[model samples]
Target: MMYVFLGKNVAQNRELAQMLTQFQLEFELLTYDDIDETILNFCMAHTNDCFDLLTDRLQDYRSRSDISYSELCQLILSDVEKHIKFPLVIKDDVVYAGLTNAEARSLLLPKKVRFMLSRQYLSKSYHVMMARKKVS
Candidate 1:
């Protein structure tokens, strides 16, 4: 299966990408500049609110006095890259945004296990990665 990864050129994003690579998971990486209307629409459709697709860092931007929550949401929906979050992982119909290592591990372990079993019965050594996705 192919996954879509949206993230910036930051340490955390890089680390997550590396972990996914080590798992032999195939994915397409998209930076802020690469975000487009189609991707935004997919994210909005899968998440309850567009903000649910953003990173914690964008939470601070959402709290700014100049913009209301709705306005911030609008900006995100409009694909305002700066207001968007980093390290977003989309697979099947699920979208994972701003996940920690532990969180990513929890989410990925099951999938990785499934992949390994699908390939070979051997128990392979694999690191744990965790993530969270806001699904309705």
Candidate 2:
């Protein structure tokens, strides 16, 4: 399973989809309507100390209107573009990619999932440290 968090910019998200297509990997685009406790935790685990901030933004955005749990996911994409490191590829095992767009695009889909997992653990990457417990 691959969950791709979408960006605010249509073009960027489209490009990301195209990039995934080029890699020949099928993925589902995660949008505001996908928010939930699990999705929130996923974004929180991926983000660096920004969960409260995101929640607050969602509250602020609610303003005078009601919002569903999934509707609240607008915060993750609109507020934390720089923090997104999606294409959370889950197959035989759980594996995470880098925080940057370039890294996620270039380093994630091409390499074997096992290789990425081992490389992350070998380097002791912070995300890997969290992914093992928090993401999976």
Candidate 3:
């Protein structure tokens, strides 16, 4: 769905572009000058949401440098997780296809989903824990 071409020279980059002209892949041209604070913020917020923000934003960064996309994604995840503490286990592994709600249920069964919130009232909820499967 996404193709990244990071070349050291104009000729090489252009050749890659020409080859991909018909594939209908989403393509972006990135250089050192392309990044700004807005791009950094976008990367941070979206990375927290899906963990693919680096893949979406740093394709060329990895290509131009020695790093691979997987490494970049890991680095981004590490940096983001440092700032937040939540009760659920977070993972950055790529799921070939997106997980459906049923699949998520199956995966989390026998496991508990925990929340850190603590409040006295129903609306403000004290911590919540989702215990796995139960027999009737």
Candidate 4:
């Protein structure tokens, strides 16, 4: 269970780290400055995959798009098992937790969790490139 948390500040971000601790969730924290091109590229790929789905979800509900991460933790705390499988992106309090997989069964999972190629391929490609770089 890998949780990648993007915190805006080191001090401000501790709440998430603590919450994860309270729930015994393992996570890596990254601030805005820590986002390199590679990480951003991977995140963007995920974002792009959910763009249309997000638009559709937004259309269905009356949700405040500008929610906070603290609030998101509470939501996840309510149903950890349901939210545990996928990575989370909680920006402005609008939580998109594995929407493609959660909303549709076998929708983006097979395509995404492959070894190489297709679906959200950028993250895999990035990892491959980095591994090759390290090996050499």
Q: Which candidate comes out best when scored by lDDT? A: 1
lDDT of 2 by residue, 1-136 (tens): 5766554666666777787777678666675345455655664455444333343434455454676545555545454444333333332233343224565655556568647756877888766787888866
Least accurate 10 contiguous residues by lDDT in model 4: 100-109
Residue range 1-136, candidate 3, lDDT tens digits: 3323132445644554554453333445444233334443444444434333333443456346677645554554555323121111112322211223344334422332212211233334322322222321
Query: Total clashes, candidate 3?
Result: 0
Residue pairs in collision within model 4: 66-92, 67-92, 67-93
lDDT of 4 by residue, 1-89 (tens): 34344433344345445644654444454443343444333443554442332223233222566655445434434544333333344
- lDDT-based ranking, best first? 1, 2, 4, 3
Instruction: List candidate 3 stretches off by more than 4 Å.
Output: 1-19, 49-136
Cα lDDT, model 1, residue 117: 56
lDDT of each: 0.64, 0.53, 0.36, 0.42
Error of 1 at 86 (Å): 1.3
Candidate 1 per-residue lDDT over residues 107-130, each given as its tens digit: 765675657655563323221112
Candidate 2: give the clashing pairs. Answer: none
Which candidate ranks first by TM-score, i.e. highest? 1
Candidate 3, residue 103: the lDDT equals 46
lDDT of 3 at 39: 41
Instruction: Give the 10-residue window scoring lowest on summed lDDT in candidate 2.
Output: 90-99
TM-score of 4: 0.32
